[model samples]
Target chain A: MIQVEGLTKYYGALAAIRDLTFAIDRGEVIGFLGLNGAGKSTALRVLGCVLLPTSGRVTIDGFDVVRDPHEIRKRIGFLPDTPPLYTEMTVGAYLEFVARLRGVPSGRAKARTIEVEERTATRDVHDEVIGNLSHGFKQRIGIAQALVHNPKLLILDEPTSGLDPVQIVEMRQLIKGLKGEHTILLSSHILSEISQTCDRLLVIQGGEIVGQGSEQELATQMGSGGYLEIEIGGPSQGEGRAPVEKALQAVRAVAGVLSASVIREEAHVAQIKLDAPAALCPQVVRALVAADIDVMRVGRGSAQLESIFLKLTQTGGQPS
Target chain B: MSATFLIARRELGAYLRSMIGWVIIAGVLAVDGLLFNAFALGGGDKRSSEVLSLFFYFSSGTTMIASVLIAFRLLAEERQTGTINLLYSSPIRDGEIVLGKFLSALAFLAIVTLATGFMPMLVMIHGKVSYGHVAGGYFGLLLLGSATLAIGTFGSALTRSQVLAAILSACMVVAMLVAWLLGRITERPLSEVFSNLSLHGLHFQPFQAGIVHLRDVVYYLAVTYVALFAATRVLEARRWR
Candidate 1:
């Protein structure tokens, strides 16, 4: 449903996105993973028909975003990070307006508004003034506005940003519900957030796409064992990092540990990055325990997505 | 209805719902009344035409100022709040957006301008003003307002913030208003150009005095068209940024 080739956008002297090329089939929810300033938003805006590319070509459902914006616009729905809402309007009224604006016949706007309201589960606050609603509702309303028209492609930028855990789950469920109806391109800086929600991942860095595939595909192709970072706490040791090394080396011997690097050693704790199979994760923990080098906590290695992202996207331009 | 009309209806609904629209109308009415009583009727016995002229005179100034306030929010607020995305992503043309916005503001301004009719009718009761004079003066007011609102729409399209839009529009309208002053200070060809460019002095006066000149009509319409065209270009150029 979407095709892009050599798409680039430059904000005078500086390029926001460069030579981006990707295509998404109908009914697939694709996650755009990148750190902040990754040009994810820039790419989505062009696909949404809101921004014109500096060069290159993009077509959605056979219509070029540049040459036939009118047709392309009709086929896509976009939810920018900040919900574009008229605060003074009631949620119901706003949705109705957007529904009609997107080409819903005036006669059907009422039914369409109600349909979206129920779809996003915002019926309770339908008549409430938008500004008075909480941030979560506003976000849902933003999604509703995009879907009210029932566009073929849904371009959502950081849909879960700035929401509480409960709200996040609600949004996640709502997005999942939209899976079969629209082709979705959702963006997020956090790796795990969209990982479960999307069918495939398109990892970007410095305005360039470094990797694209399913989680398993990326993990296998990225056979650098994925970076596992750990912090060790102890009184003292050789080079002040030997005990941590001994414990990590034990995990390495278990078969899945590819490599481990001590990124930092401060006080009793040390930070380490490990590349290993998921099956070997327990052995790494057991090795640290056996060596008697008190291991604080071990989560998924940072070297997986975060480290790979850093290398893939040279973090020079990423926001602090 | 046309796409333009659909957009206009939504915009008009917005005007009715927002307090700023009513404030502009109420404020203009108050100013128009005060000016009528204080200046037009306050002077000693005078010709009815003179009094009517005075009413049109003060009304023109307030009307122009009101037009700017009404038009300043047309596109700027949409861009500022990020709601312009809805319009941009729709299957609509920039021209429809501009024309829709213009029609909405014009309709609202006309209603506000016409609301002061009771005051004029009062003037007509105790005095003798020609109906042609009243109709001509109102026609002039609407045309002048159309031109100013169009210029304001262009100013609004250039910025995202409503405050900046107001300032830019004020600067543009004031420059046009004072063109006659520039005309007074310059020489031959230059002075003539300035006089012709004056949004008020040269063109509006003929309409205000019940003298309908095709040239004045053409001038206002031309200004309206050029301003709208510029506004459309600004919308298109924003995608590049």
Candidate 2:
């Protein structure tokens, strides 16, 4: 568990994060979503005890970060925006060194290293020099070092940053695999990145947390309402596209259906974006299936977080 | 203390595994050997003690230079590579981190200094050499290296780039090296003050001549203390920045 209240950090006259308050429960996987300079890294650094907050209180499990940082450091593992690594060291030696530094007993250091290497799937490259490894491997080694100590919480800043698509998928899967063990709070700019791995999200903007919830909960609470995106395959065999349109129009005529627009048109699939009140999602999905339209995908709209995030940060005068 | 030694042991291994360690050792020994042959034994029949004294004289310069070179990368490289975050986020105290780095550099400098012992033995064999004199001279070399390395450690802590670290350390060493000349130009009390402040003038001369005064030992220890203390404070203040 973690508790942070009014945690404000100032870099000279500029306040990086101000009046931030949040508490994380044990075993919760939370995503920290923010635009650039949104104070995510600053907040994470304060929580990790790597940077001191100028004014506020932060405690991990019961130990105050400012007064008892060393004790807090024993309970949390931190990976900064850029994976801090020693290029000269091999992956195995580096992880083992971190394990010992985090107070793992020498007798159990190797076992702990092996445990984390396997957990992060870095065992195959254990003997390779960190400098020689690819970016993905180096990033994995960075996470491995943090996990090797087996701390209570993991604070990863931009975990999938700068990786190619494949590497990003691998890193996301690796983090997902770690969900149940550690209280993970990861930060990223990509929505899909957070949506796939995190159970809930805390969207930050301009040093303040604007929205916090699961995808649907946030869309519902923001009051801009949620939209259902249904991608249907080509027109039905004998029935024309009018049935699909009439069915959609009929669904819109249903109580919470506000409006709909076509977003994308691939060869066989047509993507539709809905702007609707929060209550009409189920009726819309049911109407499509009842009309015998082959739905390739039934999911939420893509710009749900973007709209909510921009409203919070780009507001004229929003405070924490 | 356990954390201090744990960090120190790893740092020492880093030095041994890297090419820079062997470069300093090879460079210093090769220069020492060449100087020993060119100056100490090149001329005619000199007293064994004088030849041994010359060997110590040339070795002192190289040892001081080597100390600066070896200590330049201690903290600066970590900052450059962003690896200092590991130490910053770890449970170890700031003072422990500094002592760990200082101890590692001192250990490697000791190895390099000892590698040239064969030249001293050669001086002893052909001439009438006192074992105590050689011991005293080597002691002086080590103490000088330790003081220079400590100063270099403080310099390295001030900057993030290795080039800037070396420049700062060289300037600090040169200022102290020139203090003796300043002492020569000034009046009595001020001259005496500069003389004592000169890193090698008053303190190192006694050890160079086969005598180990407690005052000289105390001065080196004091410099080491002040420099390492300053470096630790610098590391701690960085988190705030």
Q: Cα deviation of A174 in candidate 1 (Å)?
A: 0.5
Query: Candidate 1: lDDT of B82?
Result: 91
lDDT of each: 0.86, 0.85
User: Scoring each candidate complex against the real one, what DockQ results?
Assistant: 0.55, 0.57
Model 2 residue B148 lDDT? Answer: 92
Determine which window of 10 residues in candidate 2 chain A has minimal summed lDDT.
Answer: A311-320
- Of candidate 1 chain A, the 10-residue stretch with the lowest lDDT total is A311-320
Model 1 CA deviation exceeding 4 Å by range:
A225-311, A314-320
Give the Cα RMSD of candidate 2: 4.3
Q: lDDT by residue for model 1 over A18-106, one digit each (tens)?
A: 89999989999999998899899999999888899999999999998888998888888899878889898899998988887788888
Q: What is the TM-score of chain A alone in each candidate?
A: 0.76, 0.81
lDDT of 2 at A182: 94
Q: CAPRI band of model 2?
A: medium
Q: Could you give the DockQ of candidate 1?
A: 0.55
